[model samples]
Target: MGEDRREDMLDALHRLAEELGETPTTTEMNDRGEYWASQYQNEFGGWNEALREAGFEPNQVWKVPTDDLLNEIRQLARELNQTPTKEQMDDRGEYYGRSYLKRFGSWNEAVRQAGLEPNQRISQSAFREPPDACRLCGDAPDAGLDFHHWRYGENKAGCYLCRTCHDDVHAGGMRPDNDPGWLMGAVENLIRCHAKYSEETSVPAITSRYNIPSEGLVASAMSNVEM
Candidate 1:
């Protein structure tokens, strides 16, 4: 009777594996059967052990059907076929484009509606003047101004900084040993100083004299000093 029961249980396990589209190894089959027996010990106490005692190697007792495995492979292939490719992501303007949309959703929609080039970055020259000094090192240049966000996010009102200063800020300041906040604070103070000077001198002269970036000075003057 015990031998008959063991054969029945092994057959059931093999059928179940076939239905699940998974091929269980001998060790996995044994482990899973034992685990199931252990879980229902109160109702089917020692049944797993009984099967083992009946000369059945639990590991070699079950197998998934080939048809079920093939079905699973087909399903996976279908999923892969439906998934987006890298080219599709680029066409949809993901990543940086997504980030931009998150900040200025309206602008993104407008650009799309107008059929404008998605790859074209905003020209700093479009703005009448620089918003403030370079948020980084406080240097000014003839062109190539970009707004830099202290914290990354959309609609965060980034401060305009020179590329050099911007790189420094991104690098978390020159002092690797010091806290990052120290560099941020230093950059903020420099912006504040530039703002104060912008009030008295020509924007260009103030930038040239102090060797501050035009964007930083402008941004400092316009932005809330408390931040």
Candidate 2:
């Protein structure tokens, strides 16, 4: 009885292959074949094993284009409005998660190739999606990205940032070991505001621009950093 069912599965697989003129995936078989891919797994140990038994080769990842896989990620990102997790890709994406791992060597690499950030979070304000947007200003790469060191000595491209953030780092003489070094930039801007507008006007202008909470603290920061 089991042998008869096995023969039937082989025959169904062969028929499907002939109709398609190439080896079909387990999903394809499930869609078009008389039997489900699960039935083949029950009899033949797995989809690829069943294909080998049926004289057809398993599909190769290289046969698919790199852009094809990356485009799928891009499409999913547009839908979710963020870089998707591996399980999210497996469930909602057209291709298997393993396909990305095999093609790109890592899921993060695949995300990066799609021109997005890996392990993405809604960063600094309501900024979301296309991981290349500035973590501070939330500017897209079209506005220009600058290579930023994560720390004073660790010259790693740790974060994606815009030219404005890049200039702020230097202009404020910030050598932060982490984060965008925003505090010093605030101090510098507030001091500049003091030079242009009176202290009364400067407080509101700098606070509005930097999103500083304590308006009085701007005066204190200016006092300490004033040259």
In lDDT terms, which candidate is top? Answer: 2
Q: Check candidate 2 and list the clashing pairs.
A: 117-131
| 42-140 per-residue lDDT for model 2 (tens digits) | 788998999889876676422456787788888998898877766667678866666677667667678889998654542232222224345455455
Q: Estimate each model's TM-score.
A: 0.22, 0.36
**Model 1 Cα shift for residue 155 (angstroms):** 4.0
The digit string of per-residue lDDT tens for model 1 on 1-227 reads: 37566566656555434432233333444554433543323333555553454444545643334343323333432443322222222243222222222323423232333343221222322233453234334444667667655334443334566876555444535332566554335445554555553454334443333333345644454354453
Q: State in Å the error of residue 75, model 1.
A: 64
Q: How accurate is candidate 2 locally (lDDT)?
A: 0.62
- Give all candidates' CA lDDT scores: 0.41, 0.62
